[model samples]
Each structure stands twice: as C-alpha cells, then as structure tokens.
Target: MLDPSVAAVRRAVRVALSRVAEGGTALVALSGGADSLALAAATAFEARKRGIRVASVTVDHGLQTGSAAVAARAADQARALGIDDAEVVRVEVTGAGGPEAAARDARYAALRAAAAARGAAAVLLGHTLDDQAETVLLGLARGAGGTSLAGMPPSRDDGGVAWARPLLGVRRAVTHAACAAQGLEPWHDPHNAEDRFSRVRVRERVLPVLEAELGPGIAEALARTAEQLREDAEAFAEMIDETIEDIVEPAEAGIAVSVAALAANPVALRHRVIRYVVDSEFGVALTRAQTLEVARLVTDWSGQGPIDLPGCTAARRGALIVFTARA
Candidate 1:
C-alpha cells in the first residue's frame, strides 16, 4: 500500500525533473535524514519512470563520532531504493564558525564535486516547508530585510550546476510518513535536538509558541511569503539590470551610477540598484545600516564627503555616486 504522501512526493519529484533539460542525469544528496531519504527514494522512482539516470551521493562531513557509519547507512538506503550508483564522499570541515555551518558548506562542496564528476546537470536537495519556515523566522529575528525573509528557493543555479529543492512545498511530517511506509528507519542527528543551534531553538521553542498563538498554518504562511518574495526579488533584479544600462558607467576605481537617476527611481528600486553596485564592485553585501547610510548620501547630502563601506567606499562625485575600494 503506497502512502498518499509518498505518491505526492513522487509527483513533486516528477514536476521538478520536468523543469530540468531532458536526458541529463540528476544527483540526489542523501544525508540519512527522513527528508533526504524520502527525496532520494522519490527521485530514484521518478527517474526510473522517466527513463532518466539518477545517482545518489552522501557526504560524510567527519564531524560526528559515527559519521562514516551514518553515511554507509544512507548509501544502503539509496541502494535499497534501486539507486545502484550510491557513493559516500568524505569531507573535512574546518574554520572558526559553528561546526554545523562548516559541515554544511563542506557537504555541499562534496555534493557539487560529485555531481560535476558524474556529469550531472542538477543536484536535488530535501529542504522542506518546515526548514523554510525556520529560515524565515531566523531572518526576521535579525531584521535582515526582504532578501533574508525570502528564505530558500525551489530551484537555483550554483557553480554551473542546477540545485533543486523538490520537497520545498512538503512538510517534514510527510517525509517521515513516507519513510515509515517504505519500511525505512532514518537516522536522527543529535545536533538537531541541541538547543545550542538557532534552528533547533526556533523549531522547538519559538515555532511552537507561534503555532499556539497564531495557529498551525504559521509555517505554511511563512513558506508562501518566502516564495512570493523570491519571485518579487527576481523581477526587481531584472528591473535593476535595465536601469543599470542607462545609469552605470565604468570608472577607473569601480562603477559609478548617476545620483539623479537613482533618486528619481522608486525607493525600492533604488535599494536594489545600490545592492547591485556594492555586489558588483566590492564582492560583498551591505548591512542594513550601510545600505541606509548610502541611501542618505545619495538622497540627502548633495555634495558631502565619501562614506566608507565594507570592502568599498561610496562618494558623491559630480552628480554621480561612485563606489570603489580604497587603494
């Protein structure tokens, strides 16, 4: 008896595969979690039905005590799902940041390398609606503006490979149900239960309160908001590109945008233009304070001095705001 959730997940996988170019292989990133295992199973099933080859790759971050065993378990699960080409790649996570984030970065790096090596066109992840909701809440806690609030996208391109989250609309509970129906036991990562992690805190503490106060649909609402914001951001980016064609000019230090044109545009578009400038010239994102300061210089100060920013400086030069790094 096939679970309805499993059927729905298979449908989602088929839809996701349809978006990619035909006859290209897909690599599923399996992490032994219920969400990722379900994704791997669904992808394998759908790929077989569509006559597309699918490979499952698990990254062992070597952070946990028994990570290698866990990776092996994930590979076995993939093999059980008729994925004959399941492989486990080992990665060493380093840096001063949290171990969880470092592991995640290393894990993705491994996945990308595996996909490239296998000539895969896309890498499928299992981030679900619950993860999206948690991300939105974390962004709100930091008050990081619309971009942060947008959370994760269903599909994106990174390092010349398409990354697709096929289960973004599905709940975590559905994935668990699917695993149970398939008679598979997913490994539980202890880090997920630790309150030291902000996501765990949000999942266990904050989200429960929000659900009790605001109702059970809070996660759905946040995920929907994120999707809408992602679409709006994409459209805004296209507008910014068109606007840049007329206002942006190459300079010795960096790029310069006409202040008059920037001021004339709507405030929302103006912010996007500024962000584009900073990202293009400095290769860094402006903090909220830095963005506001730049806006003030462009709108209020007609001929004021330069304002120093991270990795670059913004100054008003002859009706044009020039952003360049200090020499």
Candidate 2:
C-alpha cells in the first residue's frame, strides 16, 4: 500500500502534470531538501502514468562547502527515482538585494535557461504551504499591500516558460514523511538552520511561537489568507484592466487619467487605479502614503503643485491628473 503522504503528493503532481501537453516534458527544480525530493519523486511517478517525460535540475549556488556534491547527490536521487534525465547546474550568485535575494535571482535565471533548453512545458517548484505562510508573514511585517501579501502564485508564465508549484497546498511535514516512507535521503541545507536568514528565523521561531499562543493551525490560517488575498488580487486586476483603458490616455511625458472618472469609483478602486497607473507606466511601486497623496488631487483640489513620485510626478492639469516622467 502506498503511504498516505506519498499518495497525497502524487495527487498534487498529477494535477500539476495535467497542465503539460500530451507527452511533453516537465522539469523539477530539485534541491535535495525533503520538499523538493518528495516533489521530484512524485512527479516522476505521475509523469510516467501520464506518458509525460520528467527531468530534474539541481542547482548548486556554491554558497557553502560541498554544495556541488550536494547538488550531484540530489540529481542522482532523481535518477534513482525513475527520472533518467537529471542534471546539476552550478550558478554564481551575485547581485544586490542581500545574499538570499541574490542567490534566488541567480538560481531562477539558471532554471529559466534550463527549462528553455529542455523544451519543457512547465518547471515544477517545491514551495510548500509553510513557505507560503512565511511569505505572507514577511509581507505583513513589511506593511506591503495586497499584491505582496497575495504570496506566490500556484502557476505563472515568465518569458514563455510556465512555472508551477505543485506542493503549495501541501504541508512541509508531509514531504518529510513521504521521503522517509520512500526510503529517500534528503540533504538538509545548513543555511536553513542559520538564524541570520529571516526565513529561517520565521520558520524556527516565529511560526512555532504563533502556533503555541494562537492555537495549532496558524500556519494553515496564514496560507489560507494568502490564497484568499490572491483571489482578490486577480479580481482587482481584471477590474483595473477594464477600467484603465477607458480613463487613461497618453500624456506629454507619461500618462493621464480623467479626474472625474477616477472620482466616480469607490475609494478602494480609486486608490488601486492611482497605484496601478504609476506602476504600469513608470515601473515604480507607490507607497500607501504616495497613493493617498495622488488621490487627494481629486478629493482635495486646493491648487497644490505637482507631487514627485519615485520615477514620475503627478499633478492636476485642467480636468485630468497627469503623471509625467521626472526631468
């Protein structure tokens, strides 16, 4: 009999595999961690049943000693689990935005290249429900808006490559159980235990404390919140697309929105539109305070001068609020 944990992960992989074209390839981003090891094994089993080819790529960030060997072992495990095509790609992690962010950027770039070279329909990630919970908590701590709090999407397309997270709805513990049941040895990254990383701290300390104080299901609740917020964000995105086309027009150096049209919508929608305009046009995100200041142009027209935003300026010119690039 198949272990319940293994069955659960297989079910998820089956659903994610449905997105791939018939007999198409799917690449698994394996890290040798319990979550990713379980994901690779499940994807291998499910892909075989569906006549789909499965490949695995283990990225070595070269951040720690023996990282290459760890990656090679992960790839070997993938092969042992019925994934004949397993490869290890070593990436140099360099960039701004801290070590964690830089490593992530490099890893993703490698994955994108690997996926394109493999002609895989989708690249599977192993981010579990606990990871989503941590992401939501981090967003909340940063006071980010709904977009940030929405957490990671289950699936998204980037540069013609589809990225899928089959385990986002599954618990991390289940992955461990599944790996144990399958007699698979997973490499626990030492970085995951270091308190210097915010995510590690959140996983080791914050979540446990929250569970103790607020009951047993805080992680599940946080994941649920992220899911709900993502739904809301999708709905809002549709509404914005519909409303923006009618009220927005090209301006001298940027874009302009009809003051009357913006004023007619509810305050929530109004703020969203204001933020959306600046973000879509100027490629800069607006803070809540900045958004409200722009909204004041319509609500409180007191002959104020142009307000400078991150990459643009907003001012009420006649009957429209013009957002122009800063000279």
Candidate 3:
C-alpha cells in the first residue's frame, strides 16, 4: 500500500496546480524545510503527468548566519527532484513589523516577483493546517476581529500573480513523514525551536497545552473555524459591495456615505460600510473604537463636530457623512 502521507501531499499538489493554466510553469517556494521540500517533491512528481513545467525558488531571508548556504542546498534538492531551473533569491529583512512579519512580507513579495518574471501561472506556498491554526489564534490574541480570524485563503491573486497554499489541508507531521519516506533530508529551521517568536511559542507551548488539555484536534478545530469564517466573510464582502454602490459617493477629498442609509442598516453592516469606505479611500484601517465612533454620527446625530481619524476626518454634512483626507 502507498504511504498515506505521500498520497495526501501528492493529491494536494495536483489539486493546487490544476487551478493554474496548464502547459505553464509552476514555481514552488521551497524553504529547505519539510513542508516546502515535500511540496517541491510532489510538484516535481505530478507536473509531468499534468503536462506542466515545474521549478523551485528558495528564498534566503538573510536572517540566520548560514541562510544563503541553506538556500543553495534547497535549490540543489530541487534540481535533484527533476527541476532544472532551481534558483535561490536573497532578501534583506527589515524590522518593520518585527522579524517574523518582515521576513514573511519580503519572502512572499520575492516569490510573486519571481513568478511574474518567469511568467509562471502560480506560486505554491508551504503553509500547513498548523500554520493556519496558529494564524487564527494570533489574530484572536491581537483582538483583530472576525476578518482576521478568517485566516488565509487556499489561493489568492496578488500583483497579477496567483499564490496558493496546497498544503493547508495537510499536517506538519505529514510533510515530515513524506520527506522521510522519499529518503529526503529536510532542514529544520532553528527559529522554530526558539521562544522569541510568538509563532514558535504557540507551536511549542500554547498548542501543546491546548492539545493536552483539550484532548487533541484543537488545531484542526481552529482550522475548521477559519474556513467557515472565510466563507461567511466572503458573503459579507459581497453584501458590502452591493450596498456600498447605492449609498456611497465621492466627497471633497475622500468619500461620503448617506447617513440615513447607514443608520437604516443593521449595526454590523453600518460599521463595516464605514470602515470599508475609509480603507478603500484613504488606506487607513479603523480600529473597532474608531469605526464605532464614526458610526455614532449616523445613529446619534446631535450637531457633533468633525471627528479625526487615522488618515481622514469624518463630519456630518446634513444627510451625508463626509470622509475627507486630512491635510
């Protein structure tokens, strides 16, 4: 019988690559780790059957002492797996949102750029179910609300290139087992063992505790919650789009929404509409407090003066609530 881990990962790669334009190249963002290496191996094995070209790109975030060397070794593994055009790209990580967030942003941007340069239809990521659960948990810790809890999509389009996480349905242990079954040695990142990063702490301490106390399957449950939230969020997004068109209009420097229209809707929709308009117009994300204060102009009108926000100002101009860019 075929190994269950191998079968599971291969099926995931096949299904993920199926969405990409056939007869085109698919790039795997290999990090020399089990998750990405297993993904690369599966893609290499499946691409030929699908008539799709496969390659791998190892990103050197230049954080660790020997990151470049690790990336080179990963590229070598990709080449050994029948991918001839394996390449390593190095990036400088800034501490903009701390080390982890900065590194992720740089790595994904580099992957998308590589895809566009090569005309690759899709870039496959190595995020597993554990990653999704951790992400949802982090969002919850930050009080990031429902949208943040929705977690990562299976696939998304950014900068005209498609990005996919074929392994989100797969477990971290499964990827490691798949690599072992293939006689492949996977590089373990030392950061994963450290408690400095919140993610590492979650993986090591929090999740283990949750699994022990909750009797396992907590990660799967979190992943399932994220999936359901994503579906519901998509529906809410469509409703917001449909409602925004009729009630919102361009204002002096930003946008305006009908106060009467906003007040007429449920409180849930009203806050969403307010935040959506500001985000789209001025690129500012309003906190729940900020959004609620803005909503007050509609629900509790009493000749209140203009309210200051992150990148814009909200004021009641008769029947309309105007959001103007702050000078």
Task: Work out the TM-score per prediction.
Answer: 0.96, 0.97, 0.97
lDDT of 3: 0.91
Instruction: Encode model 3's per-residue lDDT on 1-327: one tens digit a residue.
Output: 778999999999989888777699999999999999999999999998888988788989998998889999999999999999898999888868787889989987888788888899889999999999999999999998788998999998877667899999999999999999999999999988989888899988999999999898999999999999998888888999888999988887888999889989988878888889999999999999999899989988798999999999999999999999999
For candidate 2, lDDT tens digit of each residue in 1-327?
A: 999999999999999999887789999999999999999999998888888989999999998999989999999899899999999999998999898899999999998888899898999999999999999999999999998999999999987677999999999999999999999999999989999988899999999999999999998899899999999999988999998999999999999999999999989889999999998999999999999999999999999999999999999999999999998
- For candidate 1, the TM-score is 0.96
lDDT winner between candidates 2 and 3: 2
lDDT of 3 at 42: 96
Candidate 1, residue 267: how far the Cα is off, in Å: 0.8
Ranking by lDDT: 2, 3, 1
For residues 183-234, write the lDDT of model 1, one tens digit per residue.
Answer: 8899998989999889999999999999999888999999999989988988
Best by lDDT: 2
Each prediction's whole-model lDDT (CA): 0.89, 0.94, 0.91
Error of 3 at 145 (Å): 1.1
